[model samples]
Target chain A: MMTNPGNKVTQGQFSFLPDLTDEQISAQIKYALKNHWAVSVEYTDDPHPRNTYWEMYGNPMFDLKDPAGILLEVNNCRNALPNMYVRVTAFDSTKGWEAPRMSFIVNRPPNEPGFRLLRQERDGRSQGYSIVPYATDRPEGERS
Target chain B: MLDAIAKGTAAPDESVDLQAEFEASNIDEVMDKLDRELVGLKPIKTRIREIAALLLVDRLRRKFGLTSGAPTLHMNFTGNPGTGKTTVALRMAEILHRLGYVREGHMVAVTRDDLVGQYVGHTAPKTREVIKRAMGGVLFIDEAYYLYKPENERDYGQESIEILLQCMENNRDDLVVILAGYKNKMDRFFDSNPGMRSRIAHHLDFPDYGVSELKSIAEIMLGEQNYRLSEAAAKALEEYLPIRMRLPHFSNARSVRNGLDRARLRQANRLFASRNRVLTKTDLITIEESDIRGSRVFAEGKLEGEPETKAR
Candidate 1:
């Protein structure tokens, strides 16, 4: 199981996928529109396992209803920074919050370096394991 | 005008009921209190007015179909203890509520103890509960620097700070947070957590009250209670303040308040121990020089003072 190529960075709602397709992104946008949520695109160079906040490409798009319109923005973001990780986020204003309720990865770098598990030995001969992204362990420019 | 419309009375030129309602809810009274009630800290008062003006202008701009954005209402209050930080925070809540920036205008003050939990897996819910209570109002965190003690690895305060940072970003529309502490400690706090620093928009430094300002606070406190300080008593206070201020744990306004309380107690004791058969009205309400001079709380330099380095 550890050697499987299906190693994925489990983070937000749809982290199981390696990279979402254009059709899947469009479907998610449609769901957001049905729920009256605003869609936005965010990208980041350091997609560390613990990093939750990402820089938004622009403000949340409140007027767009068609998934194709959102796809254009997403594709543009992907093309602009092909090496960086990019994702689609949906913001909800319900329940007195302006939180990103749903987010999923749409694009990732070519060489997906996963995580490294660390082991710590205790005084009683017991051990502990900690998982951290291998990319963050290196310098920013050398992540890819 | 909206109130009039909702009342089903739309007379563009005049509406007496609407005018009265507007006058009642106007923030001018709250603003006037900030100017009148608090002593010194002119910069703090001015900063508050500037924020209020910005919010007001944003509202008007929105009405006119102009591009408007919500100003970051999170603030950092840096001052010594008893420097009117909490008072200003309360008045700020009232001002924001009147301006429709906040819903309730109430302030829930907390520290690390109230936000952080003692055990593992218990801090998030505790911090979230405080955030929920502070919703639609202001969350005033005193000695906020304690929320992050990098020296203590086992401490749960960092978890609480993380949760607070998240809420400060996600719930900016309805909630206003004010983190208050000494200038140096708060600076170090933001330094340790650079991400938390960027989220805060306003930084108001509450300067310590001068000797004269503390004296005036004392006079006001005594005057409000129908107690008059004699000429000699006032002189004693003026002299006492400068010396007390030089010592460690010199809380500006709070020390003055404590001094006044001690003077009042001494006056009561003096009256009861008097040889006169009957005490006159003047004797009952007057604070003599002896009353102000006799209390060694300031002279002893041990009036349950806050630590010079960290607030306890």
Candidate 2:
């Protein structure tokens, strides 16, 4: 139903809703811990949907029984890059469960300047569309 | 429209008439046009029909409250150039549209240059832009193997390939990507990139047109331009087709079309040289044997490539 050709980096679950509260985040971390899944936190200034390699907040808390440890790491990453996007991921090490099982963004910039859609008319009745994040218009690192 | 197909639930005893749904979709007209437009691709045609039938049946099943995962329509069109790959992709897009698989069936054709960028940060935006334009319908990527480059140390093509594979998997429901290129190169590409190979559902190999099919295609091309090849000219072309095929860069039907275009040019020049003579419409329209014979092809054997469009 979204008509704009622009792309928004809406990765992971519950992305369309508001940022999860600490209580909600704790509930999700607890659920992941219950399944014996390894919980990891990652943060990135370049949160492009295809930019899957986010900076890990230390090693994944493997074999950790407590959800409070992950919550601490998530907040730590958020404190370091308060204006950038941060996410918490759950991974299972069992055979055939190779990729991350679930992940969600828990931090976002206040303004969330979105992206600008660029269109160019090409030869032979062709058109090209691409998007640039609003923050990228400014210099690197200064982007919110 | 999608909701209409998704929401309807038939009673347990109700019958689903496939013929009625097929007629209502009006995809038969598109198939007929494909048959008329292309010279010969029997296997490809049958594959298209099979896919259409599959989609139609899938729609019918959905109507009966049957739950089946959406079928992956991403395809690989492997063949030589001028083998009607592009033409078939356009028709496939129409079929997808009529079947309600994609909203707008218009195809966006691109090659590696259109996607892979020269710089580190450039490839993502460029590839994403192309995907955005190609979101609703078909994205026909010709020479798709070029998106991956193991030889080039700092090439940004790998980045583009990663993004494309990601998009192809994540956006399967709305977008259909048809990767086309030389068959062997595509195989090698898949050999390196297993992710892409796994995602592709249909592999449509477009066989090269035979000499006879080339001749008929010439007639159709000439007819479209209101020009008819005289009997001798047709024979001249029959000779030309094989020679062209042997020479480097003989791109099947495209080469035939180009050869006819040259013949028409020569015919006009011959008519122009006989100045001060009133010419009949027949003379103007007819491509005489002499017109085609004048080509360097006759002076020299067709063993050599055309000097004008030589292979790189």
Candidate 3:
């Protein structure tokens, strides 16, 4: 799940897997396509620290023509995140599906870690996309 | 004979008859049977369980001189038509009865016609009869707002509404009333009857099915009819459905069922045209892409790219 600082993700938003690398996200997409498995992804534009989950179940429909621009026909999605903008991180050629990757910027949030915080536009702003660490076992100081 | 009579505890067989008492009770068995028949509606099921718990707690409290009389529950179901409102209401009646809330589990379903009589002088009896039937169980009124339509200046519907209000108040202990309709319509209905609104404590909203949900529903229907959809066909159908599902009516599960029926017919026609007397699994089971076709016109009876017709 993706959460941000300002907006609140409603019950109709997509519930995406959190803190995944681009490689991992791609691998999941490939696996889903091969197995014909449906997946749920969370997408959010809200800058709130807490994340909300909205469910969407469908196989990935990949469009290779536009690599950087990830677009798929969502079979069923909750109304909370209607017409939500998202970027895809992974693709499986065999299964014809893709999964959104972590660190994908929405509404011009920078992808770099230290640079993200510096790029903050105004008061209560951060420079880059501040990625939330997912591992619970790791101590707060140990996380990047 | 005197010696035998004097012996108060003669044998183990002379003790309390536990086996006979166990055989006489049937509450647990009835609940188990009902549970198996009720499917889907997990949230509603949880709510029902919660109500049952409250009722039990209230009963115990009363028995221990801590509480009052029977507790009445009110529930509102908002969903598209044929999404199992009436079916669930029927099951609820049985569950409530088995839980000892009411005497019998009989359910009475009504529309505006059943409540509001045709002419002047006929409204009260009609309303009363509906109340009489739903006394001990549930009165599930579909589109309940039509009871207050403004068309009739005499407005006999108001008479029916008054009677219904009285019945609900007087028979609160034994009867459960459920009003169901579209979300906006139901809100308006509630607004019209402030007294009825105050009594309804529970509200359950059922969302419209998305394309994938519709696909799953379609697949379930196909399986029930001993048929299936080819992979490509299924994907195509799913893609096509969402594009057509812009309208509220198009997104309904019932509409998906209708589409499946049409697709089945198309498949049957193709098979018959081939002059094959024997239908194989490949022929009858899988729904091919050819079996289904896209509609050029939208649900509102307008061509996809056509200009709107101006009103005269």
DockQ scores of all models, one per candidate: 0.02, 0.02, 0.00
Ranking by lDDT: 2, 1, 3
Deviation of model 1 at B110, angstroms:
0.8
Per-residue lDDT for A42-139 in model 1, tens only?
98877676687888874556644345446656887899888778888889988887888788888877766777788999889999988777657768
Query: What TM-score, to 2 decimals, does candidate 2 have?
Result: 0.67
Best by TM-score: 2
- lDDT tens digits, residues B1-312, model 3? 323322432343333333332333334464454455433556766777677667655543443345476665767888876465666677777767766676556778899888887787888767765665566577898877677766656889888878777767766765788877778888887887788788778887766666666677778778888989988778767655665576445636677777788888888888888874777779778888767553332224334543442311
True contacts kept of each: 0.00, 0.00, 0.00
The list of candidate 3 runs beyond 4 A from truth reads A1-144, B1-45, B59-66, B294-312
In model 2, how large is the Cα lDDT of residue B36? 94
Q: On TM-score, who's better, 1 or 2?
A: 2
Tell me the TM-score of chain B in each candidate. Answer: 0.87, 0.93, 0.75
Highest lDDT against the true fold, candidate:
2
lDDT of 2 by residue, A31-144 (tens): 887788888888877765667888887667765544554665687688888888889999988899977888999988665667778998999979999876776687875666
State the displacement of the C-alpha of residue A38, model 1, in Å, after optimal TM-score superposition. Answer: 32
Q: Give the TM-score of candidate 1.
A: 0.62
TM-score of 3: 0.54
Query: What lDDT score is found at residue B278 in candidate 3?
Result: 76
What is the alpha-carbon interface RMSD for each candidate?
14.8, 19.4, 28.2
RMSD of each: 16.2, 17.7, 31.6
